[model samples]
Target chain A: MLKTIKLGLIVTLLLPALTYAHGPARVKVIQDIEINAPVEKVWGIIQDFCSIKDWNPQVSACEITEGNANEPGAIRTITLENGQQLKEKLIKIIPEQNKIQYMLTEPNIKAFPINTHGSSIILTAIDGGKTKVEWKGNFYRSFPGPNPPPELSDEAGQEALSSFYIAGLENIKKLAE
Target chain B: MHFHNTVILFLALGTSLHVSAAPFAYITNQGSDDISVIDLAKKQVIKTIKAGHKPAGIAVSQADKRAYVSNPESKDISVIDTDINLVLKNIPVGNGPVGIAVSPDGLNTYVSDWYDHTVYILDNERLEITGQFSVGHSPSGLDLSPNGSKIYIANRDDNNLMIFDRHKLSLLATIHVGKAPFGVTVSRDGQLIFVANVQSGDISIIDGKTNKVINTVKTGLFPYAIAHDDSNNRIYVTNQRDNSVSVIDLDKCKVIKTIPVGEYPEGIDIDIARRQVYVVNWFDDNVSIINTDTLTVTGEIPTGSGSRAFGRFIQFSDLP
Candidate 1:
């Protein structure tokens, strides 16, 4: 009877953990950059996920598994630093308007699990071959259970993501030139 | 051809003798998503022009008879025609454009892009963005000197006031002030610049000549806007969280009186002709009229519904 009571208490505590682990962690960052290129050139390069590996130092490979490239519902697997993987889906795409929106779908991070990820990239051509590329996104973590670790805080995560984008943009500029 | 030449000759004579008229005030209504045309002589909202999403800050150009409305959600500034009271064009600005100020000569309109931490310089005549200047984070309110020599911008994030030369659009100096500075106004004599520090609930007076903070005067909670009454040598500050207006004696650098107003007064304008103060209450949905002589609420003008839809930034002008 004593053993049964102890087991019941242990189950009560561990059951909540099991239920919480089912949901992925959430992370969000909103950033923008003004790229010096034509709107068409910037849009073309951003749409091709495979080219991201060439410019983005943190990203090793990106493969589109479903839907058309740059189209809604398109899924892509991305390999990040240290061979870690993340899956994302293109939720929206507007080529004529030079806007793209996407969300993270797979390889749910346990530390900073992404509950929802949405990004919008807009390209506006300014004078003298300059295109203002504004990239903004919101990330929400799954509620309940473990919170994001110190290194994976919203501010730090955004800084890392912005750096990656800056690197990729510099590469794009070099290639265009 | 003779008749056309005669008409052109009269037009040239008229243009040469043209007098600089008083500028019209363009007030952006965040709640209504429209711009209110205030005819200063009539002292009323003459017309409302539809603008982009969530219009907040407005700047008027006397030279071109145009107004720019900053719509944060839309990420653009809606350009309006003063004569027709209509949106003539929408110029794409940066993210979270909150505050706008036009040059004294009405040649350029400086828009503070809050989230992007940049100011977009739009050429008034060309109606295009000519240059961009980086400033402190989350710039909220902007004001230009009467002489059109310097532009003062209140950066909320850094709690600092940034000065830029109007001609070059180059950052001149950054003056530290109270916490969360929001509204900024330069005195008529060009000697003092008053900044409302929202978080500190006070106003910081900056010496324009020295480019340094001179004094700090306590205001009500969340002082959001400030305007100078040159005729009376007074400065009126709107306290949003406190729902009151604090009258500062400019010469003494002290609060003369704190008049009880409607809920969450955000925008303030002083009518020198009538010696009356018009304050837009964010929550009360009305414009509180205060008699400057008595320093009391004399009347109230009903505006939009809810706190957010109520009268926001107000400008008093004589233009129709």
Candidate 2:
């Protein structure tokens, strides 16, 4: 049994079949916030992949390790306030759709309790010049077996991702407003 | 998406069954642990059958008049009698059974164990395990040749495809493919083999006769399952991350079109009889029906949560 994955990330997105190949069922977390600002203003606040550190208070420090910010294949290492580091790679930046997609290039169980995580942030214009920010992610638990401890269980992974996205979205709304 | 289980209508076995039965798509919903049977003729869900925990991979066998579903979490396989649309038996297979396929004759069924790295052979009639053999790490997709002579297994971690003799269960050849290959398919004539590499985000086309890589077609991010449309001499691949399907022209061996689908599309199968393609979306919990001629999404039927019909999920209507 090979415990370590040869690749840094799981390419196939979310499904229980892929979960069987790695760990438990993949958990999906979606959090959104409405800000009293225009879509363009909100997108400008977090268009850069490295801007996550400025908007998300939990990310203490951020640096672009490879390629250019917001470009495909770009790698960024974000250091959390707790001192845990996780690497994420930019997959796409769709200006027309006002959506940005990225995934974790390195798994940090202590930080997120997940093996792999793919996420996207989208901004949609609503009524009254308000902008809606939605942060969504799909990830599997760090533990690879059927049974996992309380800290590394699926619930823990979901909770960690939900809280992370909620905090980020709230801050982005505040900043954009 | 919630489907009323009460509206499910069972097809009775007889002459009327053959006359009324149009092609049906069986979707294995992982989140809800059930199967959503979609009536292709009506383009709506016909029934929902409760399956084992975390049902994912599904293979339909017209010869056996049954469909086998892999439940990795439950560590077993659920056999469904297609006629009655009910679970006939639950056979415990291995540590983690993910990918599955039934032989052309419907006499044997192969199950891939992700954790154990083993392929188990089962007697479809007797509902018993007949043989088991080792393969590369994390076998995720299983496909048999048209003649049922050779079996194709995609080793996700090893980044390779293994060819085995269906009868002897002996290794024949191992060909290196792109990174993290998840779904595999063979042409109708068994002339070409297609492997969807998830990590590489491309499809490796192999010469079935020589067992060598012929060409590589780039797809949207994280290509998962593939569906071959032989009539149009093209193939459709589900891009999980891209939320779209890349239509590949077999003649040019290039992606001709990209059709946007629901979020997190995983499993895909072609209804050749109806000239339609069914793609299961995990995040959206719906199946997108594509018009083959137009290469556009014509309809979307809400299915159970985490709808992943990983294998050949569409049952032909001509079968009795």
Candidate 3:
């Protein structure tokens, strides 16, 4: 019994030499809404990557840099109503598919809820001349560590994203109609 | 018959990862302020020890014989005696300590202050900040070379990997990686360094000798951390967006398999001896244990809510 105990102790000491417990970022929010407008009309309102400021009241203005307006590598510098700014690069633009994908070039503190992989605004045609627009995204909270601050926590970020998508979709419907 | 059972036990213990000689894995529950002690051989959580608030980063000093856990919200580091499984001390450091790494010699521990943008060096025995040095913004994931001569840090917001000298705490080099670079790891032989870029959904593999990104391998959405299997030259990356882990073959530089795990699998570690990988699911509030050989989840052990076992969390110890 003594020998067994000693051996167990030795084995235990050497076990966790390289074991690491590193958490990857979490929190994914995919919000979608049905817009009572034709798919073509809805896509027209949100098609231009820089035109986000026109329909989305949250964005104060947008400036396009590099490549054509619809090019995949086109960059957009957007300033929100709160003076918050972000640099985004257009990854893809599939007009036939009614899908536009853009990635966050700078996921800085100023870009809080947008610190994620590229978000897509996909418009799918419905049978009743309506469109199902998805303003979905995958992201980790701005604050990486546990017990995040109120504004940067996962819950707070999720709420902000949900509200942003809902507000944008609601306004787009009103404008498209 | 008694002697025969004892003999059988010893025989079983001789093989690595046998059911008889499995080690204890200490997992930190961020939301619950507790630690889950798991018996790998039994594939179950045997104990839950209370800890400080929001335990995030962790490291083990096998030589000093203690496990250090960084509680970012509490702004302190908790020291747990590996043999006794009790909190020995809670030493305060800079604000927002996220990533932690202990030196190979076990005399000093390095902690990254995420908010302060500095790395604090602590005296292992005294648990006092002996030194600190500034680095890039949002220093999150940190790892040390086995020789304890080099340090690597993932600057989350800066989108770069910063290398430092272990002794002088001097800036060595900064290599630009993918966006939202978080978890950083150095290979067993210190010839390779891997960084999980959360926003880019890819890994930047850096050559240890040149400190340059040799290759970028695409993974599932939001890969947070990675575990390297030295024997097979395979890397297991935990993807948060899709709730899966991508198994990458280093030799081939491609993801060969993607294993689905629980919801929001964040923190991940492996017991090389048992050939088992343990992942903490944030949303599911449990630990998913994977049989590395088969690349399958063989068991799911219930744990505290928001279980995030980050850093060197799984300590192989004798259950006390």
Candidate 4:
């Protein structure tokens, strides 16, 4: 009975470690570019939520469903290149300040179920002749889901997310310039 | 006319002779929850003294023989008696104390509160909070001028360095640096301040006299800490992501060598007496000793459990 109790205690201590072996991963990417245009000009192109499909290469289509296009609490649906649809809510938006922040809300990607996606874009005038635009995103993932998937490694998932964001930003820069 | 001439001559000579000494490197070890005492004599961790919870940043006063260590979780500064290898007091500071620096006269210690975005000034003699000044968000590393007239703080969230007049506590300037500036150290001659841009993986060299960024030198991936060795005219930067140390020659403002170390090298300290460098690796739970002259790893000292306690900062003293 003593040996059995000791074994039970040992299993209890190791249970969490074994159960949480597979977890989600986080990835953050920041990109900046100096556009030879005024802040107003660059901001105008980025302010329209429906125009993301025109400028962003990866985003096939996007539409704001609720609230003003550039206002907080607005919901936007975006379709990726592979027909993966993602729904996001505008958490904060300030046109005068040339800042926009949004978080992914619905139609979660199967590879990153325990992930939160947030992105912020800022535009500032530099030397009156050019505008400096910065785009940054924070992607977080966690493990130990009810049903764990073998293909959801942290490194591979984060790499894919970072590359996707980079491609989208490059396309935006090309359109703005 | 002759009396006036004599007085002026004496003042001029005194000012020329009052050059400040080079600052000794101080590092706080978060893994051991203690401060490793490095004696420049042998260039080794002579002793490890207990401090508060998760000691991260360290500031030392060569004149007063006291070291102030910021304990982020404890929200206080652990005052260690340099001569005694013991924590004399844990003075309550602001929320999430991270960066710490002492004034030139050794009469005051300023600690950067990470959570509150404020710098708390502690009166050394009284051992109490004297005043506090607002800075940018998530202020982490700090450096004060040799004359105690200015203090520079690195705000991590804002990605900028803030300058403040030490006496009036007024804002001086805010210089935008690269992504996530975490550690800062001023040169001994008071001419340059080097800031480690963690996310950018580079070091920003600020012209101290001009208050401008002179240049940004690339280091290893995720450079988190920097230390200046005035005697050798070299700057040491610890790269957390690459687990390496980049030695920069101050004159050329270029990296001279990269010395690989254990996993996740985060904090660094230099021993001027023996011309050695100590780097703390967070994941490996050991300190890599490097010969500054040769720029190579000489030895390694294991601290504790091989967990990510982030053996973050390090400091050296002559006492123990």
Candidate 5:
């Protein structure tokens, strides 16, 4: 319990510095996929904010740290396969629009190479009981200076986030279909 | 004879448009590296002009028929000929040129370098660097008084607004404001100055004569820039994080209403003649048009991707 408290203190101290540490330019990544199942099935697979661990193979585990799942202001800490953890907060969830919006509470450069990120997932019903899932992320590279190393560059951040979103969308398709 | 008549008609239409044209908003899209020229009457992107890398800040001068765009990543400024809707030149500036302002007479342009703690002055006619002066850390937004006597700059890192005498090139006063002040704007009559505080989520109103903050008005989350509607006695502030615009009633000196806009609205400007406010949304790549009289968002014009357009971007129709 003491170790956990220390870690929380460290995170609290580092929040402002990490949040403002971003490059001049912002990068956007959008990916979408059509599933064979209906909108309800697709929403069921990803509606819970903590369900990312079950759908995305890259996320090893997830735990709700604050508030409840699928509710605004809910916070979750997800551990990646590489052991890096990312804390995210749920911004909003619109059931009528089939949209879920969330943002990174604290950036983890080791896992995503991004300073700040806001992501949204939307479900659209098609004509033949099919659902289209669109996932989008707007973020900035973690490296604050110009000419960052390839690992921390904007391209790297974009590639990592697009792949992550695509992987989650593909997995959701598989589970829903 | 038919061709001659067609030419005559074309020339007459062009002359009329030149005499009475609707205002054009130059929206700088950082992601697309271009400016979406939106004709206010049409309420759509009429043209796309390529600018320097990562164009963010903009200032339009109707008197000179030119628009200046600050490209922070490129370390340069793009000069656009408003008549032809084309870039005339990309003048290299300081280390990171972000916030820019043009004089009321359209004779000079002031650019604030974010990385370098200095503001560079350019001769509008010759388009040459004429002067430079140092300022506080991380200067983000800047504006000139209507009479062109004073220049107000918001130094974001220092959390203060610096008022400079334009003629003497000297700092008149540095007023401490809320945390992370990003945009500085002056009223039409030059009676007050509004500084948008991003972190504090409020605006500090400074009296021009005293240079002292008289009132603090609360805004939405992360207010980035401000636009004054003098006729309505209100100011519109774009809240970047909230994706909304806060209308502050100057008479009451408080927030009157919050109007929802596009995602991540970063830049805001008012067209006084038409009584409309244009808000450029960075994330949604659109401009939300707010009817000033009604204080409602009436239309959304789709612009290029990552439309920041940070500074004063509207060219009023009445200007020479």
Candidate 6:
């Protein structure tokens, strides 16, 4: 008899299966890009909280709604070029790690996508002053029930956020570099 | 993070306990609409079982020597007799049936209908719908209490966990957790419930007795699913985007070690008797096996693309 299971991470039996979500909606969007600039240079541009407008062409105007700049509880409202208004609140700002956590909260704001409230942007330093910026968001579509409209479906929500992140990251990379 | 030498000692201790001369695992390939059965003893794929369209969730009944796979696209459950390794029938289920779980006794199976917001109960012997429970929006993960008297459903869209009385078939309580709670499992002792919030990248710990969320432990990005190992008192969480497993020491309530694995790691399970951890990487078309004691990747087995392997998936010894 062949004894295939060795003591270490039983390397042999890798069973593959898919189809678990119950047709659940795509509720998350995470994308990142590598930059040639230093971590400090990149962090300096984004850490300002309200500086998103200068780096993102989609963001037409940003106003500090509450608290001081870079504060964990500071609230800011960003108006997109399409006149969509998004209210965002800073959850935390860790300068040591060059990370910022924020959440979107408003009474009835339907700016970019539905339920795209919480987001995080982190900067990691690579070898020789290179930097990596990861912009991630956790959200769902406006329609929560079954058979969402094409614009508010899971694919639409993910597509909207993916495009937003790609555009924002591309512009930021060009400016930072 | 420094790993203790105690892991080596435990590994030496675990090697002697595995009773089976062979171990096997079944993975669901969504794109191919089939199940890939792997012979763990050989580290090779023994067979690919043809299944329905978009076969997704699978639950193995140790009591009955059968495997129930939920085919969302086909809207049916394929029951496989493990001894013969053959599909007996495709039991028609609700529309968009996704998450599936069998009672510990193997008498009943639960399948969550994604589009209907309900769970269908099937009798193991007859493969027929015996009962149904209306739940919240997008119930993804369905689990049972340690004693199998209670049911826990992780409602993905509602951001809540609905606890139900198994026999009574009535809603017990609903506890709000993090955003988009997807995967859920109850502790062995039935005291704790761990819900993986995909959107929040955290695990919400619910005290079963209180039906309240006691703590939320932050993990890596896009935590799709989790599995608990009682012997080590640790929970393994698969981070889809981070490509790592967040090992949380249950006692300390923190992520102790982040074990990196393949791309888009989704479904995860811990084989306690073997002291091994298995993760299905959705995009990588393979499963990464890790030695829990050493906290290292020990083996890799390739499978079909889009492997989700959502539920408990280890085939133990029925060897004579």
Best by TM-score: 2
What lDDT is reached at residue A147 by model 3? 55
Q: Where's the lowest-lDDT run of ten residues in candidate 4 chain A?
A: A17-26
Better of 5 and 6 by TM-score: 5
Runs with alpha carbons beyond 4 Å of true place in candidate 3? A1-177, B1-22, B317-320
Candidate 5 chain A weakest lDDT stretch, 10 residues: A6-15
Q: Score the docking of each candidate (DockQ).
A: 0.02, 0.31, 0.06, 0.02, 0.30, 0.10
TM-score, structure 4 vs. true: 0.59
**Candidate 2 lDDT, B241-298, residue by residue in tens:** 9999999998998999999999999999987867889999999999998999888999
Residue B28, candidate 6: alpha-carbon lDDT:
85
The sequence of per-residue lDDT tens digits that candidate 3 reaches over residues B171-239 is 899999999898988888899999999878999999999999999999987898888889878889998
lDDT of 6 by residue, B1-320 (tens): 01322353355346543333446788888767788887776666777888877687888878777789998767789988665566878999888788898998988999998878899999987778988989998788989997899999999878999999999999999999999888888888899999999878899999999999999999997797889999999999998767799999989999999998986688787778889888988666799999988999999999885787888777775633
Across all candidates, the chain A TM-score values are: 0.70, 0.87, 0.80, 0.73, 0.89, 0.81
Residue pairs that clash (backbone atoms under 3 angstroms), model 5: none
Tens digit of per-residue lDDT, candidate 1, span A1-177: 774465345445444333222211123344556666777887777766555676666788888888777667688887887577777777556777787666566424332333445555667788988787766554533322223343334444456566656666666667655
Worst 10 residues of 4 chain B by lDDT: B305-314
The predictions' CA RMSDs to the true structure, in order, are 21.2, 6.0, 13.2, 18.6, 6.4, 13.3
Candidate 2 chain A weakest ten by summed lDDT: A6-15
DockQ, candidate no. 2: 0.31
Q: What is the lDDT of residue A167 in candidate 3?
A: 78
Error of 6 at B153 (Å): 1.3
Q: Judged by DockQ relative to the true structure, which candidate is superior, 5 or 6?
A: 5
Candidate 6 is graded, for docking, as incorrect
Model 4 CA deviation exceeding 4 Å by range? A1-177, B1-27, B38-48, B304-320
Question: How much is B197 displaced in model 3, in angstroms?
Answer: 1.5
lDDT of 5 at B124: 84
In model 1, state the lDDT of residue A37: 70
Task: Estimate the TM-score of every prediction.
Answer: 0.59, 0.91, 0.67, 0.59, 0.86, 0.67
